[model samples]
Target chain A: MDRRTPVDDRTGRRIVPETARRADRPPTRYGSRPTMKDVAARAGVGLKTVSRVVNGEPGVTPDTERRVQEAIEALGFRRNDSARVLRKGRTASIGLILEDLADPFYGPLSRAVEEVARAHGALLINGSSAEDPEREQELALALCARRVDGLVVIPAGDDHRYLEPEIKAGVATVFVDRPAGHIDADVVLSDNFGGARDGVAHLIAHGHRRIGFIGDMPRIHTAAERLRGYRAAMEDAGIPVEDSWMSLGATDPERVRRAAEAMLSGPAPVTAVFSANNRVTVTVIRVLAEQPRRIALVGFDDIELADLLQPGVTVVAQDAAALGRTAAERLFRRLDGALVAPERIELPTRLITRGSGELPPAG
Target chain B: MDRRTPVDDRTGRRIVPETARRADRPPTRYGSRPTMKDVAARAGVGLKTVSRVVNGEPGVTPDTERRVQEAIEALGFRRNDSARVLRKGRTASIGLILEDLADPFYGPLSRAVEEVARAHGALLINGSSAEDPEREQELALALCARRVDGLVVIPAGDDHRYLEPEIKAGVATVFVDRPAGHIDADVVLSDNFGGARDGVAHLIAHGHRRIGFIGDMPRIHTAAERLRGYRAAMEDAGIPVEDSWMSLGATDPERVRRAAEAMLSGPAPVTAVFSANNRVTVTVIRVLAEQPRRIALVGFDDIELADLLQPGVTVVAQDAAALGRTAAERLFRRLDGALVAPERIELPTRLITRGSGELPPAG
Candidate 1:
């Protein structure tokens, strides 16, 4: 006789425990829990038949499958697949190493990655590197030790040679936003250089030769690319770039505010300014709103209320969600047997002209 | 002979593959990869000694440990803990199931949970339920199969008895932002009732008796609480709410705009509005900005660029990050051997009175 009591759905109550009700209940050697072996024995079937039924393989006869299914239901058994996964040497999951999750830029990126993972029937394991190289390496190594199928990294550091062995050990990796240093790998990047150049060129075309630039730390790849674009635009137009007109350091609001004020109040005050990245753009807009100058400004990266601001701000807009989606799609394709060599994909950015970028230089 | 290669700091190169001589080399099998056993054999030490060195566990003689460590470094051996974790029945990771990850509210909440998890030396595995109950159950069950140490769920489903077995097996679980149905579990909730009541009372004090309530789906727990608070405030003011003054459904922008227009245009237009959530508040603000009537509004949650708009948005603000942090801390505490029954934690929400909430009814 079967020892399990079936549960009724209507009343939402569990039947009494069989062992608790009777002191003479037989002591099961494998404890109170039921296993597949017990289900097979109860169904009077071979162990392989039960396994085939559980895995939904095609070899089982219909009558035998029904009996195994009934036994499984009666025994309340669930397959323990962790052991099987360990033997197969693959976990249908990938790691996403990104910057701060709370930042608006990364939020959409994470969502995009999650959608791709879901569609591919893979789970995502993610961690924020917090822009720290040591933390990034630690998180990456930990994910590798868990035997994830692949990795999608928005690198916080320039160097990632620590991943060489793991990559050579058959873990596919793709870098996003920036290239890995001292390594050759697939990369997806936004056209930061072209976007910045066009934004600066737009400011210059609006009759502003003296354009100040406020950006992130110089060590950052994107920041350096944007700075180079600014210099190239000024040189192409034969406009002398001043030392005081450039601020390449931290992205804090106070620092950005100081940079904007210094350029606006210098001996040869700039008639326009170009802000790099969203955080710097927001701070620069606030500073410009406070100043008396009718400065023409163009920022790289769009913000939420840029359209609603007084004299709406113009910007060079990069589709952050698209960047993430494209990167994630490439990652899954690689996992799906596309063993092609490493490729670099770049998505173009658009220049959105509102009022600020079109402002005429004050005499 | 030792095959170890020193790490190159300048170029960040570690070891060059033997495939450098050939343009293309096929990946090796899993067994061909170096293991702890191989390292121990190469170093002339026992497997346990190698494990001690790899796990940084103590109780090894200094010279012997150094030899094992050097062997590990030389062999490019990374410890595989999959088998060990399977035997131990814990992944040292927690699963965070949330609604929409891209939503500004949930982004900070996720980051807070991650911070708490990191502090406890645990990794986080997260997925978006996309506000679908089936998806929620699927994601939750998948996490359970992975044997996560605990779960932090922002529930999308009204029923969650599917998690009973996992909980019975001693997995710690905590629900945040909403309560799980048909289950007894720890929960963390914001003061939705109190916040909505205070916001409505503030509008009433401003001489706006005909208040409109725009809420989320009526079935949601927090939405119901906020709606109840609106009714309580109306009763306290001795004002009978008309049927047209309440809009309860999805918080989509088009739906909310139509609802806001219906309340403002028809006979007996409301003088003030109480938005139940952030998405509703945003849509309502856009509609109100278009109308000439001076309608007062107090939204349930704070949003970015609120202060920058004309007549800065007033809000009944709940600290989403704090809610996530508190819940995650409690979960980790439970994992650390805290044997206590499930408890309910309520965090307070604050009201910020900007210009909108203070606007009197149009004469």
Candidate 2:
């Protein structure tokens, strides 16, 4: 009754029925080999017991389960579920599509999604769209074709009508950090407008009338929202925003550096500056550091070592991790049979004044 | 004969298929359902021809390909490979298991692996082990159950014999940043020992004999190697090592601060400190800034804005992105029919000497 005793002369390799069948039989079903069920019937076991052991679910006694498991191990049994859909119909996997994986902003967001997915006993399949619309569509459609149970998207493209069919087919979708255009979906976002408004208002509160705004391209949703916040803050203070005071362009270091310099060294040099995002913030900080250290600065999005700097740059901090976590949670909830219409979840941002925001307007 | 004409009722609401199956007997697989054969039949071609069109493969005639594509789109024929895979043996996906996704080191690594996976037209499934051995095994086995084509592991545990079966089943694996124990596998590593020795020797050459080494836990491979390098450098310099001069513990900022304080304020204060990693280095820099500006410092792992500080921090810089890219490239090469035994690849690290490393020993 020694189960592991070798039955073959092939170097202690057990002579399992399925292994023999695989060697003797030609490939069947479009060149796909037989699955675990084929092996299970050949070895003789209840389907539920085989499934329980395969999924590592508890219930069966060790001895019987061990035999079943050994039979599975010997046959090289892989569960082929295309022919059998479980009652739950859950794949225990999610998809994350973001702007760029290499970008520091999206890195934490992707990690956050993975963390939540792991906690829920799910796997994450991710891709970067590189901000290309066609690529975005391709990547998204590819994930859909793979039948990922849910999706958490940091959308690069505004329109997502391509996702309509997949969404209808029960693939729960949640947008993170940005909304999907031309589609209604659950979206989790940071308070970008409020963050930007507070950042600008902080500089104005520090006695700066001529405050400059440095932001990303105007077409970006977050960028547009931040610009609107800047305008709202200025309007609330009864200060008309001058056309020359706002600089909207690419967030590349060189461009941002020039923008910061342009506003700082202009006819009426702005006493304070509001940077829209972390990249723009870092670039502007470098530019400010090159100056006489008299101009005040407040940046949106908290960065690492922000408190360790010379003046300790102040910032309006949004929880990037929370944005990702909330979106993923909603996505899973939808997958778990929540059929409610789409809703927006906005997380608040906090202004942390750490010396730089407290600086007086340069005279 | 035009399919564009909608047979709408007087209510003006368009009628759509409500279930996957119906009584229409529309010659579909299950009423309005489209299968590969259906597409092929409609296009007057073989089943594989429609598969080629669905998979975006070249070689289909424009006229017939358009007809097949139209049939696919009109019927919303989303490919269900998950079901088809019950017959097919291989899943075109790979798994990436790493320490923590949130860490700056692994973010780029994950992205690099993702790029390689995408280039090979494969999807990537990833999980973070969070430095837990059990979790690592759990995640690894989960991916195996899903039958991924291969794995790229940043191993959290030394022993990986549990992965022997998966590897034997032809799941190609490559370890990055660390070597796998109890398993002979391909590995990509930075030259930790040499880098640490050079960093310490640089501090010693700047006229410092009493150099403190603040490193991560001794159990970690890199930390242990770096500590050995520190001892070797001290021995080569004919400097007797004092037990208090080295502190090996967790890399958390609080523990690092205490370690730095022990070296700085003790009876026999070290003239210089060699920090073993970026987190420890940053903490030590903060601690040094509190004291008199006399202590020299050399840190392992270059960080952003290292040169921006008053006395620029010196570091042994390892190209993290390069490590990732090389490892991923090797992995995909193996997947592309390169059947070779596992080999180890070591990337070199360089020590950059700024003002901090050149400071004279404190009086």
Candidate 3:
């Protein structure tokens, strides 16, 4: 019973059913393609000679290899990797599950992971969960069914108990930007709590007692941690927070714009603001630009053109590339046989104060 | 005789050698994993019963299924998809190769492609060529080796004759952003030439004759087309172009900064500038903001927070998401048996006038 055997010894049937057999496969997709047999026939050679040439296996003579290459070109024969993957028992690929691929924050992160995977001679399969728990589970399990050598997940779902079987069955797994819930796993995250506290404290030190906190929903772990840091900083300064000054919900432009405007229009408008993330910060910058008085601001994530703005946006910048690289490195380490217990690693954040966070409360 | 058979009839050996056999596999990576046979033995059931239970196949009694599930949990057995993919002809995955994954311009495009792939029940494997032609060819062929059902390529390479065999073997392919070279394939591109011409014409209409063009290397198709547009607009205005007014090379910040400064300085310098791409535009904005005298500017490709800038950036905007979606749709259509000859598609670009592109020439 070699692990590579496709058929069960007792049943004489494939371990998995052949529901998508070649005969049943859609003709438009797989049909009308040349096979190794066709190449061999065209070259007047054995199938082994064709396979050796195609795989670069090095047994065929130069003449035979040339003929096979010419035959392959003439008939357009491609070695079927599905069967090769089955024989090899390793796909040399990994899966990355993230929240959104379009977010600027994720661009560098995904690229970093890709670089690391490439270094390890593996390709990356990326899927977006769209922040849905059900979708997250489906994508994760689907990648598992693809038998990726490893997985790096930015957990959109809290309870990842569904991945227990996969992890236990030897798929290397690493969680990035968030921790896996209800499971012990390797995790790499930024100091979301500490970074938020520092950003809020920067505003506090700037002589602003009243500040608004705009962030994502509190149910999200990073959002919750950031909100807690804001509160902690406020408490440390002996400044009471008002319900009117706190707006936590979706980070969509319209919602953030309304929240910022509402906080600014009140009789006791906030003198400063602490934005939790890049998207929220961008919207907040727009709202503040239209204001007659200067409102101090600090954001959690670094944005593309933040430094070039009028009053350059101050931020608690997390190294997105570093987070991705670290998680991917850990994943490859696990695949290379690191048998350590699952542990959490948090990278520190840097606060860059250009002008906005240092602005004084307008009289 | 079956395509799914791992062994060769003539040689009595695996077509692809078992180079990475279980015994030769890294002990820490795959050796510790439990197997389906272990689960069967633990549950006192046959291997077929375990397979049925794992795959959710019917004909197993509820009591027996429960037993198999429990054994699966206890033994940490996960179904191997490599074997399954071998039995079925399709891997249900696609590949995307782009210049750089970290570029903001590509983020939305990749996301749009992913959404289409999701709708079609296919996963996307992404690789970054980092603007290298060799790497682009390598990544493309590797995806072919992995048997991706289709490919969406924003090619960094011009010579794509390497992909001819794969395409002929029935792997659907669609080129985006740039057209393929030396190969016939479906292509989706933006109207770079028309868009740049319109943008420059708008600048000329604003009463500026000495307009500078800062762009990427002319080797890139889009850059060359944009440069052609600039020339057309200058010719249309009957303004003799100055050789000193054009800078074409890498779009790095340092290079662009030097180019913009040189164009703005010296006797009888350009009164306005047309940036060829987003990266160049961003650098140009920074340069223009620092100038004591105002310099009207138009840039290609819109940037995030452009509207919020002091003098909002303006330019010809190509729909990146639409490019990706159209390319992906075309690839799937080819896979669905569209026997139409390879065609080229050019999507229209929009001219957005914010503020930077509408300024008067400074004295």
Candidate 4:
């Protein structure tokens, strides 16, 4: 059964829209588009004449062609290029399904993908999954319906079995930043585990036995991997960990602020912090700024103006644009049949230190 | 003639790949999409059976449908939804043409537009003009060829008469961030003049007689408008401005650093600087950080983490997301048959004071 969602208002309330799209989207129909017939009617020409004008085929008189062109212009008629392309066998465009466009991290990544696509003389269609599994499926399927030549997906859902059908049908796919769930396709990932381990280890190296870790929800693979890295770092140092030192959930400022405050005032207060990602790092920076103690810190992901702040933020940085570029290149390779097997490639991370990670632990 | 770009290689050089999008893009044959006929051939099923399976029509047994589906999957056949949509008058999609998706300022704005589109059960197709007028025209026309229901444009071109045909053909458009040039359309803009005037006036009131202004290229309407505001503020205070105090050009870091250095070391060294935009402001901040003397600054457009700095940055803040939301809402209203003449809507900007704007003139 085809599924439809209730429209959301500005306040997040569900409301029925006055029919922007139909609910019974049969395989035979999707949305409306102005066709050659509309142009013919507006131009006072026959269907064949309009088609001739659209196709640039000879035989139609110049005057009649002009009239059809005017009608096409006036009616905003768009020739069904998708239908014609069906016979040709390639859509010179690709789909990019990312987690969210609003996130600063993804903006460069998306732009890099767009640049690569442009250089390849192809257009790009982008959709944000908004971190919803259903939304991801709906968007990916919608792009398939448009018949994009290839797809670059940053998977929001663990199970991408639904995409198997499309992939088998010649949709070259490459997963970026994260792995596709249950799929054996080309995947490009940063060394999240190694980067997190090094960042936490940097904090541990600065004479800090007690360290706090703030991360995203455990459900996210990256977040879980980062947590595992923290565990490994602590184990390597033979330092006992505390329950109060670990906090995992959304990257919302309020939650992160509370987490930082709790760890600072906990039974065994942490002397240092290892922020797992950019969002968490930003909030921790704010929290540490307001507190009196000097908390040594190391964060994953580089941020704008990181060097300007007092005690410039130390970070384990991953190249977002590079990740996108590599994945896109691989996606094109698959389309060109240059690649033989589904490969997993992991890029390295770099740790930058200025003031925070090198700070001495406060008594 | 239909235009096509050759694909680019990783070395930042252009090279034709083994095969990609065809060089020729006849209006009639944009790109090819897989068809159901190919699927039928692959499955060894009759065309009628394939049709029945695709449409989910009854009478085709489950076994036969499975075979047809397998063929469909293997063939990468995407049901031609655009062809079906031809009978309808709306595509339930909108196109957004912005400067660059990689820019931090546009991320929230694009997200807001997408939110509005989603609220109306519409999808968004975005194209970056990359600040090139020709590219802007190409991207806009391409979106029109796809028959998007509406358009939200952040125009890079000074002349947009090319869009007249599309607008006349019932493709509703709303210009955001910048006014449409050589064309009449609904435009939503921030009060650039008022905001700049206020920002510069704040610096003047802080006991500064000589203040510097660094802005973007004069060709951009916002840059020129902000410059005018700066001049007006200086004239209103009866403070004659020196030509050496004003630097206008690209907002790249090296140029801005040079401009700041020149202004600070000029014969009549400025006591303060009023930066025209976020990019300039960020660069100026970095330059000022290295100098021994403190130079007070008030910038247009707020920066993230502005408050957490040693001295919070005061800015004349314009709501980017609000501009996008308003423009998208107005575009949908036009689609809903709002029969009104094009009107210009200007949203107000707020002056935020934290520390920088309130600084005393340094000795």
Candidate 4 interface RMSD after superposing interface residues: 12.7
Q: Where does the lowest 10-residue lDDT sum fall in candidate 4 chain B?
A: B12-21
For model 1, the stretches where C-alpha displacement exceeds 4 angstroms are: A1-47, A70-76, B1-32
Please write out the lDDT profile of model 4 over residues B224-311, one tens digit for every residue.
Answer: 9899999999999999999999999999999999999999995679989999999999999988787788889999999988887768
DockQ of 1: 0.26
Off by over 4 Å in 2: A1-49, A56-63, A72-89, B1-49, B56-63, B84-88
Residues B279-326 of candidate 3 have per-residue lDDT tens digits of 999999999999998899999998998998879888799999989998
Better of 2 and 4 by DockQ: 2
Candidate of highest DockQ:
1
Give the docking tier of candidate 4.
Answer: incorrect
- Which of 3 and 4 is the better model by TM-score? 3
Stretches of candidate 3 exceeding 4 Å from the true structure: A1-78, B1-79
- What is the TM-score of each candidate's chain B when compared with the real chain B? 0.91, 0.85, 0.85, 0.80
Model 2 backbone overlap count: 2
Residue B76, model 4, lDDT: 54
**DockQ of every candidate:** 0.26, 0.19, 0.24, 0.17
Candidate 1 vs candidate 3: which has greater TM-score?
A: 1
Better of 3 and 4 by lDDT: 3
Proportion of the native interface contacts kept in model 1:
0.35
- Model 1 chain A: weakest 10-residue lDDT segment is A12-21
Least accurate stretch of 10 residues (summed lDDT) in model 2 chain A? A12-21
